[model samples]
Target: MDTHTPASHEVKLSLQTDLTPAQAEILDNGAQQFLEKLVQRFASRVPQLLAARETRQAAIDAGTLPDFLPETAEIRNSEWKIQNIPTDLQDRRVEITGPVDRKMVINALNADVKVFMADFEDSFAPAWNEVLDGQRNLRDAVNGTIDYTNPENGKHYQLNDDPAVLICRVRGLHLPEKHLLWQGEAIPGCLFDFALYFYHNYQQLLAKGSGPYFYLPKLQAHQEAAWWSEVFSFTEDEFGLPRGTIKATVLIETLPAVFEMDEILYSLKEHIVGLNCGRWDYIFSYIKTLRNHPDRILPDRQVVTMEKPFLNAYSRLLVKTCHRRGAFAMGGMAAFIPSKDPERNEWVLNKIQTDKLLEANNGHDGTWVAHPGLASTAMAVFDGVLGERSNQLDISRSEDAPITAAELLAPCDGERTEDGMRHNIRVAVQYIEAWISGNGCVPIYGLMEDAATAEISRASIWQWIKHGKTLSNGQMVTKALFEQMLKEEMDVVKQEVGEARFAAGRYDEAAVLMSRLTTSDELVNFLTVPGYEYLS
Candidate 1:
């Protein structure tokens, strides 16, 4: 990648890829200066925090387990609450999320939901064009001029008069914006995503009586929360917006993050509204964070539902911590897509309702859905529990017993099956193929799968093989057994997708990558980190 420096900016901004006229407009002189300032001021600290994560992981690997921080006990025991949430965010009974594609932006915002999280993380593939185009799409959406025309069906899509409140989710700290560099190094991808969106849309959003709302992902500690708080403060000051003008909801996704929920909220209390249970990634984190614990090997990904002891404890603790601190306790994602068959669709709806009802009854203010078809079913569940209330923040679980570290780390009990192993191979391969092809959110086997779910699929298989676990049929999981299954599953995938489509797609490459990931001598922290090299 060659570097191009725009002569207009005093601060040196290096670009690895040539930008078109439209892309240049999005990164014009002012935006370039802002991004450069962010990079110089805070980008250096990202790696330090990331290193801290590794240090903690090493301790866990060396037989020490994560527990509440002794130093932050004062903060947790103190009485504090985050700033008042914006009126637009108070009634987030149902939020729909998808990538920032034009059609998805229009449809998701137009859907009958309270909020639409325009994702640049798990559901997005960070190809240069895709990233820049996503920013353009979001700009149009905020300006109320976004529309899409599908060439295949000759169908047009536009936002309705009353659309859902928009929240943007940036990439996590571990990823990089490979196309852009600051001081000859790639800037943090989160900064690139946040700076562009906020610069372009913050003014318009404020004019419309809303703020620059965000969903922060994959923070393993409260210090990471403090870093974001500083960024929000700096941006607000630079733009002359009032303090607390920016709001965020942190995803309590990682295992370490769950242990610091109160401290995380305190660190960003001036600019936070809540925390969400990013259940899929949390499960993947559980496996990766405890990779060496032989006794903690998880069973099939299908059997590891939220009802498990550890997951249930995590959920209850999140609600108790968030509501006690006067913030919303949001629930996890419902990833089921509606089926074409009437009976199948009914079954899907029933499953969605059951999952959402559990969240609502457990006192969550809102929940997430992947498809617009699921909004009403999830909304109905929340509606029944909330009535006219915007949230159930008052239902603090004070009477419940305190959740312990052992409970949170409890090994899940379930039987591993050959069918389950086969399913993981198929899903992981298909998802990786779609992702490398510049599509991250994919529909497979009647479910909306993203990078997080795919991570669980591959990581589960790796952990099982590492522990030499036996399946329900008494077949031991090994590298050789997995390789044989991989070959069989690829054949199944080829037969299902047909020879022509299979050949045209990246199935073979995906299969190769899957085999390497599952059989590698050491566990990969994130499949996306390695897989990103294959993206354009």
Candidate 2:
């Protein structure tokens, strides 16, 4: 009998090999001495492979190791490490400026935030190259430099070297469009592009630990988190920073991550300084993951279940997980953006109260705001905490994108007019409506719905506005404008679509826009008025 072991390039002969008379004749003629050598070697080592197979089977049978992925990395508890200095809104709050030609950032910074984030991932309509360029601009923005002006009235963008704080949201992990953007421009990979962009552009702005960082998007799978950690940590090394020095905020937006929150935190605890629940994605997750389960659903989403027992429980768990672990459990966004019309703003005020009540019970330490208008509201609501002696972002208020409402509204003509504001608002509203009515498969005016379409209109449009879209109509909505718009539209949306019906885990019109709104400054200001004090 003859057996052979395969070389890296050659095939192996079987362990038990018997040659017929004709075969023996060929072998005798020396078909290949290599075959004989391989057979002898493999015969001697066969026992080792068999033992390995038996051990793996035994581990599975004993339920000690996963039948699959037994060799994967082991899970471990994570640590939190981000500097959080609490400052009053009046004392300090950074703004979001530039690109939009709006003073939203400067105003916000001057008005009520402890930190300002220049959004790129969910705001800009960065078709690949645009993303690269936008990021470079953001790098400049971080250092108190940006070619910016208020597009509406010809005001200039201004940032102080001593600005409160600045942060940015990069393209979510593995976003396919990033690849398209890079390749179309003859680059190899978007990830590489992003990392390089951060490196080369910040040549003059390098800080010992103060270089601009990121807000991660679409972070669901732990592997994805690990992948990003690797990329970020690697980038830090290449850029000449201390290992693990880069800080990030995680926007939990997928089904698996919501349910696996504990593990996700443990996986990212070390690098994650802040964790925010993403409402649109959270609802999307509920629909995508929990809706299928009959026992865990709400009677409908229209009933307002962001505070239901289940969500409350989950939120509490997230808050506890983050807080107990020393991480900042950041509350999700308040898309209602306060309204100018006090009545409508009052309604959002009602929602914000509910939102605040739920958040307070959970152990969250901070909330997000989308507009400068919301800054005052956030100040009023979080005044107690902001006024407190400790240093931390006030979690008492709230913080909070999107496709064309018409799916057909071209992004914008770059001109300025109040009508442009109406157009963009209408597009956002239409997008929310269409997504709710199941007309989400395609743009309201264009092509069929698929992954590409969803990404283009749904994801792309949202990012564009986030980055600060200029309208032909002359009106604008910026991260700074979010609060102002919320107040403006709160009444309009509620009055326009009365009593939205959501099936527990479904994304009704309200849920879809719950965290994606930016109407007119002053997000649900009612949260701080007498009856809303509990919101804080």
**Worst window of 10 by summed lDDT in candidate 2:** 527-536
Candidate 1 regions exceeding 4 Å error are 1-8
lDDT agreement of model 1 with the native: 0.92
lDDT per residue (tens digit) for residues 1-536 in model 1 = 11223246585868888889999989877788889989999999999999999999999999988899999999988888888889899899899999999999999999979999999999988888999999999999999999999999999999899989999999999999988888889899999999999988888888898879999999999999999999999998777778999999999999999999999999999999999999999999999999989888888888888889999999999999999998999999999999889999999999998889888988899999999999999988999999989899989999999999999999999988999999999999999999999999999999899999999999999999999989999999999999999999999999999999999999999998999899999898888888899888
RMSD score of candidate 2 (Å)? 21.0
TM per model? 0.98, 0.54
Where in model 2 is the C-alpha error above 4 Å? Answer: 1-111, 128-133, 150-152, 160-164, 178-193, 200-209, 294-302, 386-429, 432-536
Write candidate 2's Cα lDDT for 152-190 as tens digits.
Answer: 898676765455465556554332232322213311122
- CA-lDDT, candidates in order: 0.92, 0.43
Clashes of 2: 68
Query: Residue pairs in steric clash, candidate 1?
Result: none
Per-model clash counts, in order, read 0, 68
